[model samples]
Target: MAHANTVLINALRRTANKLSSGTSYQWGHMGSCNCGNLAQELTLLSKAEIHEFAMAGRGDWREQVEEFCPASGLPMDLLIAEMLKNGLTTTDLQHLEKLSDRKILAGIPSEIRSKMKYNSREDVILYLSTWANLLEDELLEAAPSLESLLKWEEPIPIPEDILL
Candidate 1:
């Protein structure tokens, strides 16, 4: 069991590193190109707008901005809250938490999850990060041998032209 845990942890760490590194580029691309598409129909300004307003205000504008913006559409706050409720954070183990009451507000932002019609990009990232962290712990617990680690089910033979 310890061996299995170690192998799994290493695999998970590799996967998480890959995912996190790729995610920065992916997020940059999405924000640049996709935000316009996502916000096309949204008349409401984002929380960033509210923040800017607060920053620009003479004194104690946070409250006024909070009242003004109120975080209507899809954003991180709603997304994080939902993630917390769903038990998708690092602390969650059984993956049995209830769906957030603000599921609609927690709409997914990524082109991938969007096409899949799931949660927003931020939500998906958080979800995967949480799982990856958990799997890392599991790997540490297992501590599998390298031989057992390397042995996955063999791939079936492919045609010569199709082989990579």
Candidate 2:
């Protein structure tokens, strides 16, 4: 799973919202597909820019992710590196492209999950929104509670000479 963080969660949600508001979407287009929309949100790049970047590679998002080399400096690789730096994992990209992450899939309601088609825009929206919610939950679970904060290690001593 990708690291639980607000950046990834918000980007996922914004991408879903963009799609819901009728952004261009096509499973066959590298710039407008599932991962492409997210790339747009994360990289602040347009669909045309994403498509141009992807053209530097030989395969689709899934294949590129599988073969990613952060040090390679290819435009697509660099774009992918941006996403990873912001909290996404290569596996997350692969699953986003295919809508097949087991945990993300399980997070969706069973009835709706059963009907989700990987390439459908509506299904992609569901997947992204569900992913965002999952990450948000994970982030909340990982945060230190007030009780834990109150119990945090010994406090630093104050100098008596300067005391008020």
Candidate 3:
């Protein structure tokens, strides 16, 4: 499991919560789709705002990702930049939008590993939760050890009477 930043984990959780709680999900709509939800979480933009930005571009999420230019000041590009800042790469966003990232899928349980349709809300939730778990595992692995925690210089001495 690769280490993922807290920002990424929090965003994934927020997206999943929104999805599971009946936030509007329209796969055909740019703002309500998979990538859009993630954009919402990372960029703090509404679905309508994301849709408006996407409309300024030439294609859907996949195409937009393909043509992403960090230098371009388009809203969609700006949204992508926000996601990137939160630790997602362009490839990560692309895979997320396409529901085709092998690494994320590999972490999912085999029983539920069937092909995931890009527009399915349930699948999106599954994907987000799985990704969050992977990130959480990485965080656990990188956590400071007890020895490290106890290594402060000039540590306070315990009272001898307390030992009794």
Best by lDDT: 2
As for candidate 2, its clashing pairs are none
Clash pairs of candidate 3?
none
Instruction: Please report the TM-score between candidate 1 and the true structure.
Output: 0.22
Assess candidate 2 and give its lDDT.
Answer: 0.92
Q: Judged by TM-score, which candidate is best? A: 2
Reference-based lDDT, each prediction? 0.33, 0.92, 0.86
The parts of candidate 1 lying over 4 Å away from their true place are 1-117, 144-164
Candidate 1 per-residue C-alpha lDDT over 1-164 given as tens digits, one digit per residue, 9 for 90 to 100: 11223333343344344445543222222221122112111213343443343344322221222333225533433422332332223222112111121332234335533443222444433443444455555555667778887887987677999776
**Positional deviation of 1 in candidate 1, in angstroms?**
16
Each candidate's clash count: 17, 0, 0
For residue 107, model 2's alpha carbon misses the true position, in angstroms, by 1.2
Error of 3 at 128 (Å): 0.3
Alpha-carbon TM-score of each model against the true structure: 0.22, 0.92, 0.86
Q: Model 1: how far is 76 from its true place, Å? A: 32
Please give the distance, in angstroms, between residue 39's alpha carbon in candidate 1 and its true position after superposition: 27
lDDT of 1: 0.33
